[model samples]
Target: MTTDFGLKETGYIAPSFAEILDGVEDDYRTRLGDDIALTSNAYLGIFARLMSDASYDLIQQQEQIYYSGFYSTAVNSALDRLAGNISLTRKVDAPSHAEVVITTEGEYLIQAGEKFETEDGLVFDLTEDVITSKQSDGAFQGTGNVECEETGEFTNVPANTITLFANPDEDFISVTNPRPAGGGQDYEDDETFRKRLIMENAARPGPTEPGIKSALMNLNGVKQVGFIDNDKYKTDEYGNPECSVHIYVLGGNDDEIAKTLIDKCAAGITLAGSIVKEAPDATGKLKEVKFDHAQQHNIYVKIDVSINDDWNSDAGVDDIKQAICDEINSLEMGQRVNFTRLYSVTYDVNGVDDATIAIGSTKDKLADQNISIGRSEFAHCDPGDVEVDLIGL
Candidate 1:
């Protein structure tokens, strides 16, 4: 073979592009002459800048390509499935399961009022006087029935003549209808106002029974309420009812009712997007949204879920367990059902050899329309101690 320089002169030297550029690195004198090299290297500077910029852009594109794997189409699918499942439904007289978040202290407001009853079984307020009439002197003469000053009972009524008496000082009153006075009707006191609030603002307490906190919370504009035991009572220097019963009332734009709730419950409260604020619904608007961006992001993914249990052991019916899981997962808020922990027990019928098995069989017989199995723990509980365990998230 000829010498490398001799072959290059003949144009027969093999060179990779990188090698060619490398060979030109030290030939600035030949390419630009001694005078040009001594002046400035602006052209080289421009080329270097361009190369660096292009390299940086390429790196950024590569990074995006790498992390795209995390944004999976399956995640989007799961989200859609989850969103669709969570919804609200209204029933004529059906019940539902719901969670009650206590935002403030609530004490039952006890009001003492009298219920006046007439001899004829007619009822009226003890505070108001009534007019009794008889065919006196062939004219409709009005006979005034004086209400008792102390007992709020009417006295001096003719025997056998209908007379009204106060039923007694009762703790509660049904104010479904307000008395009509002068031109219109209006609630005169805080007690009357509270009842109106309950009618207009209080929502159904869901599937659970009305607990102290929940019942008061259901009052209109009321954020929350409940009783405080002596041990838990906040104290001053000397332990007294230092803590005035706390009552949360929402007030704000007033247009959006939920926003009002956020305003009143400044502490011991939580407020967020509809997912956290929306009431539980079985058929109404789902509180979540789901979408897939894989085409835009170029990502792929996979997810697997499995259910397994000892069908022979008889812990809980597989069907009920499955239903519980499905219902829980379907919720939009994901905070609706309390399933973080589960407790269960088994029993044995003295006459029947396997009572635990019999209970499991009964659970299996239930219909499995919308069902899911949630995370559950097992324990050896005393027989007949198996109560439905409700654990909150």
Candidate 2:
């Protein structure tokens, strides 16, 4: 048992071996006479120490067992069990899916289950069959849906990566993806799952702004979410109609985004976004849902730093660029990029004493001033776009 007094809801302090040993020795003196040799080196005192060590271990184990019942302190199997109470399951290795366009020189008929492959050998299967419509210029093209053959992050391919057809058809001139594939994910770890689980207890995705944001953040592949509400009598400055909710989302499946809007928002409240999808409600009636897909605001960084000749400029340059990009991308939508932050991220690289940094939304407008990002824009940076010039001693 713990010597410190406390409530069970807060936490308990377990007694140490020294404390337990003193308690055991005091009890022995009360029963036996004080004339007994109870020094730590003696046989009787050593026996008491062994008993104290055993009691200490048991009490610590008891404390852990008690704490494990709560979701906040639980791990692995216990965390999974607690999530079940709120109807939330941990996200496992789910397959990615994409949209593909199949082209042909002549009238081509594509069937469902047709397999397409990437250069790395990631396979994708067509969800439905489509027949190409002949254009006036003599080319035929048709659009179809595809899902990855494997379930993991590796299955997520880039634009035009799916060039080769698993079963080659001479009639098909080419197959390609217009946009990069998404939604493939690995097994969710404990920390990410725990955050989502905690949100479930707080917001629970009801007819509220916070609830909607919380629900979207919990979705896989979602990076940032921004919300704006218009309750005026007329159209708002952002062009949202009166009594509308406008959400700008950077990532997540379009269908899932639409479905979430349908489920969480209040009935009769107008939703605003660029993309619209028809989803079913509790009564199985089709409802049109809308949400805007946030556009990427590419950020270009230019750095002039004087460093020691001993520092490896080649490797350290890349590290500086990555650090700047990581810090910027970590920010959610509508967050400001302060001017002073550039110095902090650049200095994080070793052997860099002084630096002058300039940033801009476009490469042509690079300046020392900070740029304010709008609610519907996400800050992005490419390694190629980052410019670092070092003056070595």
| Candidate with best lDDT | 2
How many clashes in each structure?
Answer: 20, 1
Candidate 1 structure quality by residue, lDDT tens digits, 60-131: 454444433322211223323322333211111111111111111122222223343435443433332322
lDDT of model 2 at position 92 = 83
Cα-based lDDT at residue 256, candidate 2: 75
Question: Which run of 10 residues does model 2 get worst, by summed lDDT?
Answer: 1-10
Give the whole-model CA lDDT for all candidates, comma-separated: 0.27, 0.81
The predictions' CA RMSDs to the true structure, in order, are 28.0, 4.6
- TM-score for candidate 1, please give it: 0.15
Deviating ranges (above 4 Å) for candidate 2: 1-10, 14-63, 66-72, 117-122, 134-139, 150-167, 178-180, 233-237, 304-319, 345-355, 382-393
As for model 2, its CA RMSD to the true structure in angstroms is: 4.6
| Candidate 2 steric clashes | 1
User: What pairs collide in candidate 2?
Assistant: 273-292
Q: Once model 1 is optimally superposed onto the true structure by TM-score, how far is the C-alpha of residue 91 displaced, in angstroms?
A: 8.9
